[model samples]
Target: MRKMILPPPPLFSALQQPAQHLLPYKTRKKGGGGRESARSSRRPQYCRDPAVHNALYTGDLQKIKSIFKDETTANLIIDSLAEELVWSAELGLWVLAPQKTHTSPLRITVSRGYRDCVKHLLLQGADVDAIVGGKAALHDSCANHRAECTRLLLNYSANPNILSEEGLAPLHLCTTQESLPCAQMLLEYGALVNQNTRDRRASPLHVAAKHGLDDHVKLYLCYGANIGHRNREGETALNSACASADKPEEAGRYYRVVKRLLESGADAQIAGRKNHTPLHNACSNCHIRIVELLLQHGADVNVSNCAGYTPVDCALHAVEDYLEGEPEKLIATLLNHGAAPINPKMLKFCVLSPRTMEVILNTYDRILSCDSWVEFVPSEVWQEHHVFYDSALCLLNQPRALQHLARCAIRKQLGIRCHQGIAQLELPSSLQEYLSLSLEGYLK
Candidate 1:
């Protein structure tokens, strides 16, 4: 992974020491036999250049006015004021918090890990957690891996939890390819264990886990992250680990994080959307081992997603299930692990077997009649979701929700589609048939 190289300070100047000598620059000599050749020409220095300094710190017109009241001011005026403002701000922050600054100082001599500069600013007066362009100075120190600077920020009472303008804290910046030492420093400074970004709900755990950073995960967990906390999608840290995203390295990182969560006693059975649990997600992705581990850890086999599909049912039917292993082992594992009985009705529903609609509509009757099967699941789990009611009701003349009811002369009752996939699901056999017929008008 490449490290993030931050740009030069906000007040960047194009002033290079101009060539003192009127000649072309010499390129470094290729591997040569000469030990010492000649002294290099020194570049000319441009001092107290005001226009350049104004453009560097903030190209904003207001900022320019605040620093140099007159645009026509001499170079010395601009230079001196700009320097003073930078130092004053630095001092204000340092006396307040030695280690923290809202923004990096604009100095002729840029401070990189300058321990004394940080301390000087703090003792003289500076707010450690001051905001600059909506950023914390600690962010800059960390981004550059200036460990000494970071130490000062911590000493001065910088709030590690304060996210910067870009939604990054010292901890987030430390995760970049640069700033390992800065990350360690923030870790030492009492940064939150699972810091979250302001723009999104991803915790530091999510980022570290996504990057496959086992070390980072260890660091975050040690600091404090609720491994089971659900993000917007209601997915816990373990659920994120099992997602098959386009990035393999990221996926691997999540997998490692999931392993850690499990070891730490994360509850995989804490169910989520469409009723899917971590075990179901594990099975869906063909992570058979993860599925098994989840089951071993008390994952519910019969807990169905909103689609009313059980863990084994999802494994047996999703197009990708074959990637992990064959079906027989999956069935055996689920059964031995206390799966609901696999009756004819369940067989059709679980794998979408070739049961006619006639058989499916009557399947509920068969299950409730069987005392052995009723003990395993709610009668509704195997039945198409329905509501039956009232001696005077009739399926043909009722409200929309009661249309699914069967109207027999023996009695009048209302039944409705509750949570069943029976309404929208298309069996494999109907897929080609629909495409073949829908595209043609002959069926009409």
Candidate 2:
């Protein structure tokens, strides 16, 4: 067996003689404590000491204690840089743009989960609340999910509500499922549950909802987190849950988040800056179950956003993006609740979605024109589902089947009560299924 030989530390050779340049300085007085405020426009001049850096990063407790026996060594702040070349618009050239970070041993230990070394550094008088490159020891501990390190820091009187240089509290830093324990500790230690970010003004609940952290959201609500608190965008926890799911399959997790929020008194119809309700957001994301839940909670199916696009329109727009997720069903659900029909001009948009076209055509009694709709679908997609598209195009100048006409008449009479009225009409199950717009890939 061969042992792996790692490269030597960047500062190993420089530490032979006293590296006076790496000693701690008052970053606050110099206005250079954080990476963003100080390093935004210009790079900072700095150096690193390998002995302490190695000990902290590697969780070497004995090594940390040996050097930190000298109090000054434990509190030293080191500067590190990430080298990269980026285009500088002002310079009009690609420049060697480096990101400089000034961090302390306590922050590094907590971030890397070096629990014992963190305790040793604290015993040596390390500032538990020390800010390094925009984050404090507590912020790093929570962000990195270092539970024990977080407890030690909190026990040392670290401020759980201390805002990072980016203006995020430690509670907001707990974005992952593993960070739930850290968040619990922060909340128990008096962290504000509804603290909003400075830029987005999103609360901790918003963060948890967006990231799909079920336990984190539950814990916050248990601690009396305000469910109705809206962000700068007027998005409550429910809105965030519906809008933040990036994948169709991932929508289920966010759906659960929205369900919990609603159970806790989150309003479903509180629109955001764009007046987009939770239903609009859910339909746009192709979340059938979420859309159903919002509707059941009395969400207005016909409510339009600032852009004048209703939830039905949102569902159509989501069709191509979520082809595998059955977006057509979302449109059917909206229509059953008396949502306005799809725009005739937009019929072309659903060319790739034949089943969606079937649902819409079944809703109308008059014959639909499809002469121009054929041109909307690409040749390849049309060729792939020719049977369905052909039958769809045939209905352009012809009246729909008698069954569909009956469905249209019954639905129109029931109006908004179409969904519930048909359920208890005492009709056969097959007749009930027909009125609910069950998919057939064709109108007849």
Cα deviation in Å at residue 56, candidate 1? 8.4
Which ranges in model 1 have alpha carbons more than 4 Å from their true place?
1-130, 140-157, 165-168, 172-183, 194-203, 244-252, 312-444
Q: Clash totals for all models, in order?
A: 24, 0
lDDT of 1 by residue, 1-444 (tens): 122323333433444243244321111232441222343253322323435464434434444344333212211111121111122453443221122122223221012554554454444333455444356568767667677677777766667776776776667766543555666667787787677776666677766555445666677787777787776667676666655422323445556667777898788787755667887876676555566677767788888898888886775554233422434445545544555544544433232211111222221222222232224434553353212211112322333222122211111111112112222445464542331111221111
Best of the candidates, lDDT: 2
- What would the per-residue lDDT of candidate 2 be over residues 183-243, giving only the tens digit for each residue? 9999999999989899899999999999988899999999988999989888888888988
Residue pairs that clash (backbone atoms under 3 angstroms), model 2 = none
Candidate 2 matches the true fold with a TM-score of 0.88
Model 2's lDDT to the true fold? 0.79
Task: Go through the candidates in order and give each one's C-alpha lDDT.
Answer: 0.49, 0.79
Winning candidate number (TM-score) = 2
Q: What's the TM-score of each model vs. the native?
A: 0.44, 0.88
